[model samples]
Target: MNSVVTRRNLLKLGLIAGTSLIAPRLFAQAHTNTQEIFITNLHTGETDRVLFYDQGYYLADGLDRLAWLLRDHRRNEVGGMDPKLYHLLFSLQQRYGQQKPIQIISGYRSQATNQWLQKNSDGVAKVSQHTFGQAVDFRIPKVDTQELFDVCCSYRQGGVGRYLSSRFVHIDTAGVRHWG
Candidate 1:
């Protein structure tokens, strides 16, 4: 039996082999580009590892869960957290070159909570960004607080507060300002 080896068949074979070889690499690249956040809320003992951004779109469900996770524990109120804040956190993770879960010391703060803290604490701001869901106090496990603070400061995107004693770094999506 003589089978004619046609150019079209050869081209099809080459294309199939090329696609087979390239598909996995493309998938891996997409996986790597996916922006994920792993967080543990210290106050509520809630944890989430979410792929919030894939390709170029932010997942609404992931954002919703993140907002719930970051809710004010005192009043159990969920605020509309700024998406930029999440992006900032994602950027921090990328900058650190690690996928460690960020331990959230604080996230959204209710007006009552903020007011009470301001009245009771010496360093708490009267008009805190946390009340507006624009700030987060967090620390990545095994990452130095100073190093994290430095990384945040380098971004110059917003506020970066270093509470060395507390072993946490405060980040915000407000105007550039910093405090200890």
Candidate 2:
């Protein structure tokens, strides 16, 4: 009996060897690069330092805790917030290269709260994305509000509201729009 080696066999072996050598590095990098979001809800006086994404997977429990933290304080309503909002905040934190907790002025407003705001405040929209769990009004401590708004605008991922007088920026997963 005789044994034979073919070019295809060598190629397959090379690929297998290469993957074996590279797979661990890829896995390590993915796990090491965890995505975190630090948030402080001003209304509720609650804070969270969440590791929401790691190893190419999102932690649902972390996200749920985030939603609870961002719940409507007045009505005690918790909306199922869009996960992208957390990712957006994470990206914003990365852009700033600062881990300071984002001060949340508003998040997950209930319909009644939104309607009340709309009726009372000229700035509030009758049909605000806040009522849909897709919006957040936030500020980063020690970061210029305008700079934060500019960075969020650069992403062009959604609407950006610069509330200079209020000293916060509002971001939403809605059609791109800007307002004071």
- Which numbered prediction scores highest in TM-score against the true structure? 2
lDDT of 2 by residue, 117-171 (tens): 8888869988889899999999998889889988899988899999998899999
Candidate 2 CA-lDDT value: 0.87
Off by more than 4 A, model 1: 1-32, 97-99
TM-score list, all predictions: 0.78, 0.79
For each candidate in turn, give its C-alpha RMSD to the true structure in angstroms. Answer: 10.2, 6.3
**What is the per-residue lDDT of model 1 for residues 48-98, given as tens digits with 9 covering 90 to 100?**
887787876789998899999989999999998998888888887776655
lDDT of each: 0.87, 0.87
Q: Model 2 — TM-score against the truth? A: 0.79
